[model samples]
Target: MAAAAPAGDDAVAVDVAGVVKSFPGVEALKGIDARILRGRLTGLVGPDGAGKTTLMRLMAGLMAPDAGTIRLAGVDVSHDRDRVAPSIGYMPQRFGLYEDLSVIENLRLYARLRGIAPRRAQPVFERLLGFTRLGPFTSRLAGRLSGGMKQKLGLACALMGTPGVLLLDEPGVGVDPVSRQDLWRMVEALTGEGMAVVWSTAYLDEAERCETVLLLNEGRLEYDGPPAGLTARLHDRSFRLAGPRRDRRQVLSEALGLPGVSDGVIQGDAVRLVLREGGTPDLLAPFAAETGARVEAVTPRFEDAFIDLLGGGPGGTSRLAERMDPVRLETEVTVSCRHLTRRFGTFTATEDVSFEVSRGEIFGLLGPNGAGKSTTFKMLCGLLRPSAGAAEVAGLDLRRATSEAKRQLGYMAQKFSLYGLLSVRQNLEFSAGVYGLEGRVRRARVEEMIETFQLGRHLTGAPGDLPLGYRQRLALACALMHRPPVLFLDEPTSGVDPITRREFWTHINGLVRKGVTVMVTTHFMDEAEYCDRVALMYRSKLIALDTPDALKARVVTRDLPEPTMEDAFIGLIEAHDADREAGA
Candidate 1:
């Protein structure tokens, strides 16, 4: 085991030493040692199955470590959770909020659970509502709130008793950018007020904002330090290449094949690449000249360093991509929405949404929570009836030929829709049967999916038992079992690691090369770069429509750094909101 950095009287909130935890067939954590200091935010960052949640649970006293000692505020509380419970607050990934209760009602309930008297809880609840910007929605039912609002409410509930330490597990996984900003602002204020916070997040960008970061891989700690120090190691090792937009795949393939190149991704009209140690600009000159692409050195971000530290390389060939039989349809318009609108009673979920997806195109719907992206998606998939207008899939009207249109495509919901009780192979077999496959064909398809997704060993394992990455793979495999022409992916990579995300997109790109149309909705702004075009939605309306580069150009200026998709997205939404207010 490596020697952990000395805590050195820095007001350590939690001290974990030589901790090891195990499940029936897995060692969840192995010899972990770290010190979380008060008044500082510590980011727990790693790939799926890296034991982030397990570590958090241990610190929260929800679970005991099989070995080693955990000290909470200088007191050993590894087995005495009752002694530590009063000083610790834990907000799990799926926070427990009463759906039937209003926001303020839920807060009062949690306060009561914590044994706070009404006299004291009222002031705290009011302050929390203001802090979370949820004061306006105090009367709204928790279940009716958007994903971001629910997370804020959860955080407020966790803070009811003013615990000295806070542990958040992937709190921003599916949250929109604006809400993410709000959440971080609140967290920073808490840390400023001398609260120790340990946050686990899949987004490396979020980790970059932390005062300290703990990097883990497969249950072992890899690095413990400031985010800047980790990113500094990759200085001069990262570069951006700009070339013909259509040559993205070719450039990525060639770049990955280059010596010393570690990993690369499509980044909105450019490819961001990370090179191994001792890699030089001269090494890339040949490829640059061949592709007529311009290469420029760029500062590496926290994500680049994280991927490099994990030894992530170019994604291997995707077997799933190989088995994807391209769509043979002769139509140019694969998906079309003409002023599609949906309403739930008096509430308009989506309105006047119009867009067309071309064959083999990757179309993305980008928006904030409650921005009607999912409602639009459901309309296109024929799951919901549009209050107005029409949509077509594979030239079949969604309303008139709903069954036929659905039969021509595959749909994966925002949540993993697979049966938790069924084995991996069983889910695949069931999916094949739903698509009307039988006999030897069903068996062959299931086996092919297992082999393609590398789920051979987990054939008998339940889907819910798999890691986040593997579960995503299984979901995608099941969605493609029948080889549909169009695929709908709803937040397909939520809570997944960067490595797995890269690998998943590699397969998607390959399938696109073979002419498959994909309509995807995602919260990860970086993933928007992979789309041929993206539509930005705000308050049940399409606010902007264009390629990622064009949308970004709307916000980019000489005085500011190059705008990311998130920046552009926020800018567009804010502008639209301002316009609506002015019109009103």
Candidate 2:
């Protein structure tokens, strides 16, 4: 913070000049310079370990930069932190909300921390509760709220002082489409009212919505301007090639190898491609000719531009595909749930949930947080004992042979659930031992995973100390040490960067081709496209189960004839809620 503003049109909320920050082993920021404006939205967009969080913390005065200065609303944070503290609101990745406290209680606690009296805080509290639509659940404990509600509460707490500059770091992480949309609208409205908002996110789509974008990567600023500056680079380079679902994956694999095809991914029944500078629409003809697929040029998205900036996504090849053994199972259906129910005392988490997954298929479990997706997932993983009915894994009854059923699959929890104290190598060894691998077999698999996931350099470091992407790699490796026939991934790419996400899916698609079955839960609706079929849960019930295309078809209307996965998700949930209200 400096000494007060220069006045009217030149109102700089936060000004950074030649800022540099370094940690023990890595330089987090390098000579960064930018000017944040009042009443404007500035998005901090970058990959994992690219200094988004570091920048947010530095601006919040949580830490002083090794070099340079950050002036907040005309006051220097490094020199006058106490004086400027009340002018800024900061929410880190994990917002500090007490699990045992009620929604209203958390807000009051924050107001007290900000030194606001109850009489003065009441009007602000009322406005926030009404704005976030959390008034009815004021008495609900923070721990009992859904992921979306928790985020809303976090934002409300941050705004307790009604600060001039608001910094939100990945507030939408682990939040579903409907909730993410709501969060975006809330932040946008804040910017409209003269609050300088800096929103950091792993999702590129969110960045594209910002009025101004500050793109950082590896301690350096790549671009600082409107999002259009990046998307314009990939102009006329993006295209969609549509074909039979069976042929698209194969065609995408082949298309990636073609001259000038920089990036390609399986999106619904088509392969979305991003071409290089010299690449042209003519390059897609060869792949389209054989499958009789239709090709049309599509506008490039911020993701396409982002991957291009990162030197393109990983190649569509998987080492696991070359090494992992084939699926060997007794039955075609590897997982089955028949009238499954789970209850915590009198409250039902999941009620009469049922589903089946065939061998080698990619089945998706999708829903908003606390919508029974996790309840159903836990029952399938044998982590929870169902209140009624039964399930089977690899032809083994979960109720009768829980241990045997557990042995048939590998589980990667949402948070990765790794032993943070153990070194990478130690974690791998421990995981192998848990799966009952012998000496030589265990050693070979450990080394194999290290090499496959490029974890050779970080062998001695604790998995928790690594970046979010590397930690994800180690988690997946630990889970797959025994090479189980079935894999259960719970929101595996929730906060991962787009580049790493592509690489993760490359391994997944490769495994599926070799006959390994997969059941995944994800908040990113785009990820639902990877599944063969999706089971959507809402308020402890399975409301829709079908292929991704079919689910989108259900929500089609004249206004939204071409609905995205996100569109289908929110639409179905709304229609279901409307029906429930009508019946009630």
Candidate 3:
């Protein structure tokens, strides 16, 4: 907002002092104070219901704080909202783009809403289409575009008038790695032009890119500094260890309980353990004997720091069935597909796709949005009939034994897909009924799941009323009501906080140990390492398939010591594209 200010020109872009907002039964946001400096990218990082979204909305002038003052570039938003509205571009967690409209139409509509002249927006739109690589899809309906493309278009529309301040809430949630890279590049370019950007995200890797970060927890500021400052907090303590699969969890748990171990987490094939204040060499020998694991030191990353900060919340439940024989399942080939193809009119969703998932294995299906992972998932679950090809789940043909196949698989869709209107207990009861569970058995199973996930405290509340983490737990409960042997999870952890994601996977690993085969799709690259085997999908085809380490090995051209899964994913995709172009 335009206002008379002190003569000094370098004022804070957005400032909040003692802000508080409350709902009926909860204090959503406690008193909070923070400042976003001019021409820099500031990140809002925290777990679900930490009030990151609320703070962003308050600063964007979308809501009135119960008790506080918020100033944007020296002007108070509460008192001068109308004047400041045009200067701030806000993108909520779920952006609103007309599904029926074309990309061009959506851009034009936003331009008109921002009061930009048609002539002036033309060049801007051209640049946007070029930057997003959406030139060929300009005429396609928004609903037909992939998730990543829609996000890019949303950004293009928000930047129509080139607002001074930009607020993005979880902009990269379901976006693929390459598209995410493009989006961050665009953001970096904008910040170079002196635009203040406030980005909120669930992925810690995304937060690492911010110039400065404000780590919020339950409406309170925990840490505020540059990105490097957060990483510096975990300097000498982090260590990595490698051992047998069955001993991994046992080793981590025993290590955590040791006198010298402050924290221990399983990362890929190793455990990243932080030493306690008075830890000594004598502690290691007894701890190794207790867990029967071989330990070694390694470099610590941001994930280790995050787990340490969350303290003792949820993790390591996966050790439940690891002590038992993991390969004693009823079915040998849990799921098998041959030349699977699905078509909607002339468009091929998945063409000649083939893959196999073994019993008691965690298999990952990695892909960009619109790469047909969901389509293939639906076909495997018997929700959709493939146009051609044959598939069998748990030894039953999907087409011939639809109902029988459904009984052998549990599916968690992209959306939590639980009824928001139904309470947690009500949803569980309904799900049990669908699986043909009777009154007594249904109640028993429901109670067991509730206790296992620690949901007794909120079972009476509506599923929608619970936070993101609780809702995910509830959905998984419903899916596993019948104890299906194979589970299909489509972006199961999308838009969830890092801590919650870690907890969710901890439960998932527990299931895998009990001989439940899992086929999952996800956007977070770090998660790829957790799966036993991973398949990278592009343009409805499987580009690469192997263990996470093997996939990374395919892309190793240099002797870089710490090449992460993200690096390998991008590198493989690039080489695949290059080979495709040469063949074409």
Instruction: Name model 2 segments beyond 4 Å from true.
Output: 1-9, 245-247
Candidate ordering by lDDT (highest first): 1, 2, 3
State the lDDT at 264 in candidate 3: 59
Give the RMSD in angstroms, all C-alphas superposed, for model 2: 2.2
Q: Compose the digit string of candidate 3's lDDT tens values, residues 1-584.
A: 12222323564778889899887776868888888766678899888888898898898888899998999867889889988888888888879999999999999999899898988988888888887788899999999888888888888877777778889998998999988988998888777777888999989888888888888887788778887776666676655556644546455555565655656555666666776444544567555555555666565555556656656335455432343244344668899999999999999989898988998788999987878899999999998899999999999998889998898788999877888888888898899999999978778888877876678989889987787778887887788788888889998888888778867777677677677889999988888877888988888888999988888777777575567788777888898999989999
Stretches off by above 4 angstroms in model 3 are 1-11, 245-265, 275-294, 318-329, 457-461
Sequence-dependent TM-score of model 1: 0.97
* Candidate 3 lDDT (Cα, 0 to 1): 0.80
> Worst ten-residue run, lDDT, model 3?
1-10
- How do the residues 1-584 of candidate 2 rate in per-residue lDDT, one tens digit apiece? 11233467567899998999999889999999998988888989898899999999999999999999999867889889999999999999988999999999999999999999988988889999988889999999999999999999999998888898999999889999888888988987887777889999888888888988999999999999999988999989999987644555566667777878888888877889999887888887777777688788988998899888888878788887769878888899999999999999999999998888999889999998888887788889999999998999899998889998888899999866999889999999999999999889989999999998889989999987888889999999988898889999999988888988988888888888888899999998888888889999998999999999899999999999989899999999999999999999
Ten residues in a row with the worst lDDT in model 2? 1-10
Deviation (Å) of 268 in candidate 3: 3.3
